[model samples]
Target chain A: MSAVLRVQDLSVAFHTRGGVVRALDRVGFSLGAGETMALVGESGSGKSVTAYAIMGLLEAAGRVTGGQAWLGETDLLAADLSRIRGRRVAMIFQNPRAALNPIRAVGAQIADVLRRHGGASRFNAGARAIEALRAVGIPDPARRAKAYPFELSGGMCQRVMIAIAVAANPELLIADEPTTGLDVTTQAVVMDLIQAMAARTGMATILITHDLALAAERAQRIAVMHAGHVVEEADTATLLAQPRHPYTARLIAATPTAAGSLDDLQSVPGGLPDLRRDDTPPCRYAARCERRLASCDGALSVRALAPGHQVACTNPLEAAA
Target chain B: MRAILLRLVGAIPTLFGVVLVTFLLTRVLPGDTATYFAGPTASPESIAQIRTSLGLDRPLPEQFWRYLVDLGHGDLGMSLTTGQPVKTELVNRLPASAELTLCGLLLAIGIAVPLGVLAAVRQGSLIDHACRVVATAGVSLPVFFTGLLLVYVFYFLLGWSPAPLGRLDAFASAPKQHTGFYLVDTLWAGDFETFRAAAAQIILPAGTLALFALAPIARITRASMLAVLGSEFIRTARASGLSGPTVVLTYALRNALLPVVTVLGMVFSFLLGANVLVEKVFAWPGIGSYAIEALIASDYAPVQGFVLTMAVLYVLLNLAIDLVNRAIDPRARRGA
Candidate 1:
């Protein structure tokens, strides 16, 4: 399958009160047709930055330093903000409440999206919007269409947002922490909804979240990010069965999986390296890695541990992986 | 609906309480109403007769009863100064004030809301800054000064003085005074020339008062809009990829309107009382200035009646704002 979306050598930085903060360092990944890829990382690890970079939702301050997010033929990273947002790319945010307009009826919001993307005419958009709402499993969608964002529960609002996102049915979907704040059951249902929708639509999806377990369950491939760099990428099964990179191992060990016993769990030590000082270039996970070696000083190169599995580390974990 | 009814029920005590205070305060002024009207040298027997007839000699409770009874009967006492029926003057005076207040409110809303929206949308830009400056000017300057400035420019320089006062020249010149409001009366008369002059006359004074009021309304609107724009739900609206205008109108303005509506209600009520200065400066016979004339003569009848009417109107205007707010936002109607 030709890559439905490709983000090559992407870097993003912000000029905050503190000198330049490298939010997203040279990172790269791709999602093939109907493929689900996860970019998992802790807060401030540039997980959202990467997702935003792909969605072109970066705020006025953050800038894409070097990137070419090729969505088939169109380079998303280089496209105008409005064009990328309203046409080819779509996103689902973490906070469903913050992702919708409080005043408008949910149906109106869906119709607006449909109209903007030319998915439906102004007159036809209303019916299409109701259809989209129904597609996302909202019951009595026609009646609910008149309800404002505040009238709907968080879960319903999230579904309404999904309806609007799927209205355009763009080739790519970036779900950044889309289920983070949701209750576990709600999270499962929302994720299942997205995955089910993606299966039916054959659209590529980039799920940016901190939950390794969730990524493992939802995504075909998982990309572990640490300090704004892609540390490891592999099929979910292979990566889970045999993880490479100390960061990836630490991540897998830290996740408290319900299916596994507590003894299998371990916590990552220290924290992400500060991305400021001129001396800030290195394996960001080096200080946190128990398997760190003296040679882990300069550029960490991508070494394939298995076919189609690339881990950026000086010494790739030779066990299981 | 019950909450609103409850609120309306609460407003009664408040209205009565405010009216009672105004009634007592007007009586408490150093000079006596009897003396002001009767002249200081009147005979003792005559004074007693006047007091008795005016119901002033009655005990405080008895007087309050009489006042309430008379009020219920739509009978404010006859004015000792004019000797004309108090209700007649009140009936005549109220329409002019009502017209001016109505026009001023329309003017304020028309200018304030759009400018406020512009400021919020273009925050930190020149338009926002400029609107801020204008708002500050509107709020700080006294209505009298604003009215005077307008009169000077429109009357002397630009030649747009408001229609002459008390005369309702347009209405009198037109065939009849069937509808008390000169504009309405004039328009009803089917004499376009008089109607045009009557409207033009109102414009200068009304605009001046509106300018004085515009700042606060604009500031409240802009601040509320800015706050709404940054809210989590607004971000959600954007994420849905609803185009910019829809996002702003649907998400931002609806939430912002509630507070702005509250401010507009208060401003409308305040303007009812404050238009006195504008009326005086423009030599327009609005209730504000008419009340001052009643104040000078110590005409207890019109004063009491006007105060009661105004208090009632203030509550009603606030209620109107609430209804409008509820109409615009159902979530608010649900108290969410």
Candidate 2:
């Protein structure tokens, strides 16, 4: 499959009262048309930053220092994204209730997005909005659309959020911890709905979350992020069978699975390195990697073990594992 | 409608409290109402007769009972100074104060809301600094001082405005009293000349009140807008690819206005209190100055009636605010 979205050498920094914090450094990834890629990372791993930077939704304090994010032929980082943001690329945020406007009706909110990007007229936007709500499996879309976000349950709000994100049938949907605040069952349902929508529209998805099990179950490719770097990327099965990067292995070890007991889970050791420091190492995860070598201190780069699998570490777990 | 009815019913006790307090406070004043009504050189027998005739010689408790009974019958008693019923006195002067207060509030909103929104949108910029200076100047300057300064500049120095006199000049006849507001009444009577004179006479005082009212409205709007702009939904709005204006105005401003509506209610109450000084400076025949004059003369009825009227107007204003809030925010409706 051809690449529908490509991000290369993306860097982001936030100016704060204390100092400048470099959040992302040279992070890069690509998604094919209709592909589902999961960006799995711990807190402060810059997964959401990458998504926001690509969407041009970063806060005023944050700046994209270096990067190129290409959506098809257009360079998203350099291009005027106002026209393309909701038309070609859309986002679903965490805490669906907060993501939706509190004062507006759910249907009117959807109609706002549709009218802005979908060429829906004022006369038909209401009906089309209800139709969009119905498409996301919201029961009684006509009545529920008139309801406000506070009136809906968490799961129902997530469905409304999905309805809004896909209102224009954008080519790329970025789901940033979309199911974070939802219940476990609702999480599964929401993820399934997102998958179904992506499949129906042939839309690519980049799911940003730290839940490795959900990523494994829903995504075709998994990219493991450490600190601010994309430390590993591979097909889900291959990555799980043999996680070449030590950080990826530890992340998998940490995740709770259906078959794994509480004792079977092994937590990833050490916290993320402080990116605010001036003398930080080139390899952000080297401090925590048990396999760290002297060579890890040198310039770090991604080396492919197979056609689809890449790892950034100097030392890797044996393939025989 | 039911909510409004409930709210009105709930306001009864508050109104009663205000009436009781006003009655007790007026009773504590140094001079007696009957004594004030009777001339100073009047014979002692006539003063005593006047006290008895006016029911002031009765025991305090019986007097309060009679007062409450009279209030129940919507009889506010008679104004000692005007020798007219306090109800009629209030009815006659209320529209003038109402007109001035409403005009001031409208002007303040027209200028302050947009300035606040602009300051919040370009926060820390030159326009924001300018807004801060304007708000600071507005608040720091006293209302009467601003009123006098405007009179000095517009009326005395420039001759651009009519004298800082009452609502209409001596030359202009009173417009046919449709609404009691000179501007409205003049228009209703198709009396454009009197309307122009009324508008000119009002501009300085109204502008003074507007300047004082603008500070709080602008500050609250800017603060509320800043908070709403930072919320997650605002980012969602931007990510939706709506135009910048729509995102700021429709999404952010709508949410921001909830706090502003609340502040507007508070500012309206403050402006009502601020009106007495403004009315005195302009010589406008409004109920505020009427209350002050009655208080000085120890005319118990008009003072008590003025406080009661103000309390009732405040209650009605709060009800209007609640309705407006319900319209703007569905969550408020749910809470109601």
Best by DockQ: 2
Pick out the ten consecutive residues of candidate 1 chain B with the lowest summed lDDT. B163-172
> iRMS value of model 2?
0.7
Off by over 4 Å in 2: none
Tens digit per residue, CA lDDT, model 1, B272-306: 86777777877776567767788888887777777
- Residues A274-301, model 1: lDDT tens digits: 8876688578888877777888887767
Candidate with top lDDT is 2
> How high is the CA lDDT of each candidate model?
0.80, 0.92
Off by over 4 Å in 1: A81-87, A276-278, A291-297, A300-307, A319-321, B1-7, B160-191
The TM-score each candidate achieves on chain A is 0.96, 0.98
RMSD of 1: 2.8
Q: How well is candidate 2 docked (DockQ)?
A: 0.83
What tens digits encode model 2's per-residue C-alpha lDDT throughout B135-164? 999999999999999999888899999987
